[model samples]
Target: MTARTPARTPRRTLRLPSWLPVDGYVLALLGTVGLAALLPASGAAAHVAEGAATGAVAFLFFLYGARLSTREALDGLRHWRLHLTVLGSTFLLFPLLGLAARGLVPTVLTPQLYSGFLFLCLVPSTIQSSIAFTSIARGNVPAAICAGSFSSLAGIVLTPLLAALLLGNSAGGLSADALLRIVLQLLVPFLAGQFLRRWVGGFLARHKKVLGYVDRGSILLVVYTAFSQGMVAGIRHLVTPARLGLLLAVEAVLLAAMLTLTWYGSRRLGFDRADRIAIQFAGSKKSLAAGLPMASVLFGPQASLAVLPLMLFHQMQLMVCAVLAKRRAHDGADTAETGGAPSVGRITPMTAPR
Candidate 1:
């Protein structure tokens, strides 16, 4: 018998499919969680990291306030209907759905995961991703900028108040002390940056790229501290593979509903295609940047688990919206090709601050 040739092993490569979207920031967050799992800070080191995380959170809001132009905010006021629609989808509709999702508990989700899911609903809409996606789809970029800014500003106050009313004891009891901490830590820094914008705006503008790194790094630090606390507290076991699968299924449904509502609802509300694009993007997504620090404050040692759903949803939205934006751009090209009026507006770079 002829000797059989030795079988060759298949080459393995580290690769993601072209259709699968993954943000670098999301990878950083996953790395931070891994670090927290392996090398969680404890004892005095934990305290120091916590303190630094607090400062990082404060600095993050400061950058937010500084980067968002007051003049742009005022200018966008003329588009009140679009802004109102986005806001309603964010605060009113989202919470109502979260309240409705209480039915999923015990069977579909653990009580703890449900609480995290609910908290995710109460968070503000994302600024950078919404702007980026809208711009990419040839949507109303200016309106997206203002709507995202407004949502963040409102969320600093509304999110905590809503969590108190909606989430109750799950959100660290939501006492006056909690609200006061939220205001002092988050609101005050944001307001300070807004107040100092005239003097520092030019500097921020000049170093936008550097400050972008700062923004992401601060968020990672916050994640590390919170997850470290959770690891130390042994709360990470609240999430199991089965429960995580259920949570993801639930979140997928929620995202699909919101996307449909934002798109169809905006069209029915008589918004043009450009404005609809902005509304769909701005209204459908939650802000992980805003949510993480707030979760750290609101959930305390339980924050790592609390923020997990938000983190997952954040990545899901980015991937889904990226695909949608590309499809939208292609549709606009098709319309132009057919000699029909181009439904979408001018093409711009996909870059936008998150």
Candidate 2:
């Protein structure tokens, strides 16, 4: 018999470490910032870019209002306790810690960086990451979904108001006219979307993927506009490597505190493991997507500096939570193994961000 040719094994491509969950969108954001640093818009071009960013922000809110299911939000009200716990952690506890961080002002953090750090605390929890992490940990998926949606919806009105109350004049003039502009830019479009949802809901559902691109593109436009304005103002020189390092350290502590609080506090409140997982993921994180547009509206030209801490925190949370989610999943499997049950299945792959 003729000798059979040996079968060749396929070579595997190199991959990133599984522990690191680097998001592509975050990379896109970094690229946008770099582009702005290199080639910022000027004068008339700046005005045109600003106007487009405003329109894009409005369109983004409109999409949010359209896509969120009214009935589901209403149904979610039944889990009022869990929602309340999450809201308290996000709005109340976070701000308190931010206020306490004032001691670092002009020492560890510059005034501008501190302001951004405080602004980071005031922003709402993320919708996509909260639900995504909760599901990965085999937690209450529906509660996670509802909690994140509620936080996003609440943030439209709450974030600006909180910034007005907390950040005051430092947010680059949160005046009556600014408030009116915000209402027109963010609230009005959202309400309009809700009103027209009956007619456009099906279209939106059909074009879900397209709308997601719109979402990311709009945020990119906002980023470009804000950072371009900053470049024009020459604010980039304000942040040194030392200050950035300090800011990262402060944010790491803040993230750890919130994570511990959410996990332990939920247990103290008599929640089950599933609900605690949902609460921990939902309550402990801030929404960079929601914060960027709002900062552009509320802080105007100063938004670039104001959103810097938020951008950093977003990346940090994602990496930390990715590791946490996997650990939680593995623990569950271990418990099943000891109980004489079959090995638990792996976590479901996360859906792409909405």
Top-lDDT candidate index = 2
Clashing pairs in 2: none
Candidate 1 — which residues are off by over 4 angstroms? 1-15, 343-354
The number of the candidate with the highest TM-score is 2
Residue 67 of model 2, lDDT score = 81
Q: Per-residue CA lDDT of candidate 1, range 257-351, in tens?
A: 99999999999999988899999999999999999988888877878888999999999998888889988878877877899756555666564
Clashing pairs in 1: 128-353, 128-354
After superposing all C-alphas onto the true structure, candidate 1 shows an RMSD in angstroms of: 5.3
TM-score of 1: 0.92
What TM-score do all the candidates reach, one by one?
A: 0.92, 0.94
* Residue lDDT tens for model 2, 1-354: 999999999999987787787888989999999999999998999999999999999998898788888889999999999999999998999999999999998989998888899999999899899989888887888999999988888888887888888888877456779889889999999998888899999999999888788899999999999999999999779988988999999999999999999999999999988899899999999998899999999889998999999999999999899888878777767877788334435667573242
